[model samples]
Target: MRLPVRIALLLILFFCADLCFSYVQKELRPQTALQERDIPNALHPLVKQNAELLQTAALKKGITVVITEGFRSIEEQNELYRQGRSKKGNIVTYAKGGESYHNYGLAIDFALQKKDGSLIWDMTYDGNQNGRPDWLEVVSIAKTLGFDWGGDWRNFKDYPHLQMIPG
Candidate 1:
């Protein structure tokens, strides 16, 4: 093969490789950061306060709850909306970017944290030995704190979702 053609091919391969890496990184970032990051500063003050209270209340019941999402950016929401549609995961959300209360910092998604420190989404897991499911307990607390449970939605039940709307 000619030297110039070989050099051109190498450059093309490098460009393609870079593009692929960038795409993968972009796709993985939100999922990777889901429960790892702190609750976003963009959350409404009252919502943030209630979230903390909800956690404390759950902890008192021997259930550790972790906020998995808060104050999502439009781009992140779009990425999530792509799942099970344009992407390779189950459809986790029905709302698009601007449609979700998360876009405005009024919503959150939560999971139960086990004694082992790992998170689980199992709604029926009763790690606390409570006859009542811990997930429902948390939802009850969240509702008292003024959060609307997505699990109650008639159309789509997003069990992990909680949102506060001004009255």
Candidate 2:
């Protein structure tokens, strides 16, 4: 083979290998589950605004809150719905695919994080030593910010869930 042609072929192979590696790396990147990236920017403007307010107000009251679930993809929602139904663990949700506000970027689920970086979903937990439950304090602040706490629902009590009402 000619030296120039051989060099060109080697460069082409290197480029193809680089592209393949990039694709695989993206596919293998771990999905964000209970983190800030789970919250999509497509959420209703009010929901996003109130979520910020809830976080800030909770912080003022010595409670640390983090949004764990938001703007769920249809596949993610189906997997959650399958839990405790066709899959193992407790039934987390009754909504499927397009059924929940999360599918429309209108809802969020929260958890309290301790100073040690441990996340807690216990509604009655008061890790701040303030005598009041951190979960309730978070929810109270959320309500004031115009978010409806799922804990107030009669049928299913999702202590961490909050959604904004459409005007």
Candidate 3:
């Protein structure tokens, strides 16, 4: 009887140890995503905050603006740089890989969305008919929120781009 009780106790202890080990493994395991297009965790917090504020204010003005690009990887930036010079399409960007502020999570590009959900990159578009261009309004709000508009740059006019200069 004593031997049987000892065996049962040993089995119970073994089972409890296995369960504890499994719990610890589950807790320490890294998490992964099911979707590839999900927003990356590396976006700077200030960029996210200002982008959200810009979106909210645009919505209130009946102007729908969507952030189309942010935080591009060096590889992605390189591909964009190749577009007009090496590749077939028009030159979309002047900055190569590491040179873009997008590579540092400080820049974002936006496009206007019409009520029917069509996206437009036209800077003079006034989909809400608010008398002012929607793109300019977005740039204005972005400036107030601490972003510098790429449209104001004298060399390359990138109307959709907004960047936060690090001080």
Per-candidate clashes, comma-separated: 0, 0, 0
Give residue 42's error in model 2 in angstroms. 2.7
- Identify the candidate with maximal lDDT: 1
In model 2, which range of ten residues has the least summed lDDT?
30-39
lDDT-better candidate, 2 vs 3: 3
TM-score for each of the candidates: 0.74, 0.72, 0.73
TM-score rank order: 1, 3, 2
Cα error, candidate 1, residue 97 (Å): 1.1
Per-residue lDDT over 98-165 for candidate 2, one digit per residue giving the tens place of the 0 to 100 score: 66778778899999999898998887888888898888888888887878788888788888899864
- Candidate 1 stretches greater than 4 Å from native: 1-41
Per-residue lDDT, model 1, residue 46, is: 88
Full candidate order by lDDT, most accurate first: 1, 3, 2
| Superposition error at 134 for model 3 (Å) | 1.1
Is 2 or 3 the stronger prediction by TM-score?
3
Give residue 64's lDDT in candidate 1 (0 to 100).
98
Q: Clashing residue pairs, candidate 1?
A: none
